[model samples]
Target: MTDRPNPLSDLNARSREVFRRVVEGYLQSGDPVGSRTLTRTMSEKLSAATIRNVMQDLEYLGLLGSPHVSAGRIPTQLGLRMFVDGLLEVAEIGDSDRETIDASLESTDHDVTNMLDHVGATLSRITRGASLVLAPKHETPIRHIEFVSLGADRALVVLVFADGHVENRVFTPPPGQTPSSMREAANFLNAIAEGRTLSDLRSDIAGELKRHRQEIDELARSLVESGLAVWENAGESSERLIVRGRANLLPESDEGAELERIRTLFDDLERKRDIAEFLDLAEQGEGVRIFIGSENKLFSLSGSSLVVSPYMNAERKIIGAVGVIGPTRLNYGRIVPIVDYTAQLVGRMISDRTKG
Candidate 1:
């Protein structure tokens, strides 16, 4: 992790104002800002020449850069990080946004997948940026487990959950396995699986088997291990990653290189596995995590930014992450709090469901 800079301390009042204006203007218009424009917009009586000198000093300090020789300057990724970490004035989430989020999530009827979809769609709509949601593991209790023999080498493990969700996993039978061993494996799972989640069962399996090691043979133990391994390997089924509003990332204008960048960002978004893995960085952090431009590997090629936060369950354990992806000039002051509030909202809803 790179150390974040505090450019404010390095700059005096006049230079700080000029730098802030440049960054804020770029964020607002997605274009470099000229000193003449700053002179016109600023309340201070500074001339364009003075502001130009200030911008030159900022540019020398690696905080601002001109896209072209004659063009105005914009904040570098490092400058954006400094502004977000030190200077950005984050706005509180409005009541209307809260109402919108509450309404959208409540209508999902406690379905985990639906809730995540609604969350992604709602955040995308609200922020006008692409949204990503990594859903928590489903905690639905197992209703029954059945192992049907598939010839001599493979078996089909059917798991029926209390939520009426049925999942089928192909299990490879152990050497010298018999039909009787399959029945015993299924019976053992059924005996302990009722009203327990797959995560719970997975953890308890080792303890349960160790306690009753004398009762079960090696073949059935291998069958159980293989069956659970198959399920564990199915990452998508157990923990879904949802992305929405990718079209929002496309700008109405700007062809050529900018268009190419958006295309690259679209390609990056297509790899849900990579994005989901990237979100693990958020889960490790305390609150909202911001990745600007090259700070994150997935968005580096696209020159994009990410604002992410992790959501937790009733016990305050982080189980998933949610975030928005946008161009580097994203309104960090606004989007940061929105992401934070959205994560908290999701945690509350999940906690409520757990209590119920």
Candidate 2:
């Protein structure tokens, strides 16, 4: 394997400290850090000129960039990577934060999809960044199935999975359908749905009808087909992407350029397919993954950072991912741990549900 050069090794203590301070300042204020600012923040008595020369050297290495010719420096994407990989000191999640997550997730413990939505909202509220949650494709066996009449033309199908997850889907009933036919249809589905997944049941429906054609009538058969058709369409939706707290991404001051970038990000968030593809990067590995600006294609145009981690199932299989998106100057030290903890909590809740 080829060895990647350690840029931290090239820097002496003073240079590293200056670079760290500049990046931290930029992350905190979302603005450039001048030499005068670094001079005061430094522990040792270094002149602003000394700090300026260090900043210039750091920029020469492509780790820092000056937004304006005369302005102070901000961490380039490479510089942010360097700091995150080498110098970042992640703070521990405080008890209050832990309580917040626990309380939010527990409130919707009975409903798995609702639990995920709450997780996204909670992360967004805490981090002040838009949260994206990708719900894993559910393949659990059907435990119970029921049909409820909504009106003359519509019915609701409630599916209970073996893992204790419940899904409610509404479908249109065929013409001339009645209460007895719906009940008969429910019975027919219950008879065949045992120990089979939604997709499995959908596939087996045609064969089941062929075998039991005489046992069921046309009305019941139509209702069954319509009901399963709804599930078939639902099954095609393997993964559900939930995005919340987009308003958090808007800058408080709302500069014209920044608002344009935020608008671009909002547009990016609306493109669920692109966001899902981008999130696939997180599921490829373990633990928290950081994608700085332009590192992932979805956020490239927005110039944002994503701190993502994959949540697992009972068997420790990667099921889905959760993360936040904000400007490149994200508070990595704090946000990293928050994302990590949230992922773990989600996994635990899923595991408990599976066990139950």
Candidate 3:
């Protein structure tokens, strides 16, 4: 990871003011900034020539770029990062925005999937950008495990919880497995897997079996191993990533070339698996991971940006992540704090549910 540089002190007050006006103008209008525009936007007693000189100084530092020789200047990704880091003032989320976020998450329900769906949608609507929530890979404690023979090679594994919730999965059984061995395997699973999470149970059973290599019948052991492998490989964790309001990422205007960029971004979003995997890396970090244009390959081609933060459980352990995605010059000041707040809100909800 490249170390984030502090370029704020590199410029004087006047230079910073001029660069900020340029960046703010470009961000708000999506149009390049000229010396005349800067002179008008600022109240200081400065001429267009002075403004042009300051812009030239900023351009020399590789912060601003010109699309053509005579075209007005726009902030490059580096310039945007500098502005966000140094000059941008984040607008506080008002009571209305707070009410929106709080109301959407208001429920005593422990149905996490439903809540995550709401979270994704609310963030999308609030930010007017594509939003996504990387749900935690929380494991449920097992009540019992059962194997029903479907044929010579396949068997259905019925996982029943103490709360009476049941989930079923089918897997290939060991060669020549019989009903008697399946029943015995189920019994063995029940004895050890009680009050243990699915992930822990797999490890627990495997460790126990290794210790007592000769105690269990070979057929029963094979069935248990198969069940573990099947369920663990299902990838339910990645499946729970809720992405919403992707259509909001489209360009507001109808310029053919500009419209194609947003279209490319939409196409990139179809790779949810890749997005989720990239989000997993975001989970490994602390607070508010900002991936600017071309900084991360996921959004490089689309010229998009991402603002992500990890959501945690009661144990203070990071479980998943949440974020918003938009154009490279997306409102970082506004979206960063929103993403941070939403992550904290979701973390609190998980903690509350865990306590209940």
Best by the lDDT measure: 2
Which residue ranges in model 2 land beyond 4 Å of their true spot?
1-4, 140-276
Q: Which ten residues in a row have the lowest lDDT in candidate 2?
A: 228-237
Report the C-alpha lDDT of model 3 over 1-356, residue by residue, as the tens digit: 34577565788889888888889888888888899877777868889898888888888898999998998899988988888777878776667778889999995367777788899999999999999788776477888888999999889999887667676667988677899999998998888887898878868866874576343223223333534212232234322212133354344633333334433543544575466568666977678877888877688899898889999898889988899999976877788888988899999998888678
Put down candidate 1 lDDT per residue, 194-275, tens digits, no spaces: 7899988977975874565333223223333434212222224233112133344345533223334433543543575465
In every candidate, how many clashes are there?
0, 0, 0
lDDT of 2 by residue, 150-230 (tens): 999999989899988788878988777887888898898899888999778867985764565343233223334434211
Can you give the lDDT of residue 179 in candidate 2? 73
- Model 2 scores a TM of 0.65
Deviation from native of the Cα of residue 291 in model 1, angstroms: 0.4
- Which stretches in model 1 have alpha-carbon errors above 4 Å? 138-277
**Ordering by lDDT:** 2, 1, 3
Candidate 1: residue 174 lDDT (0-100): 67
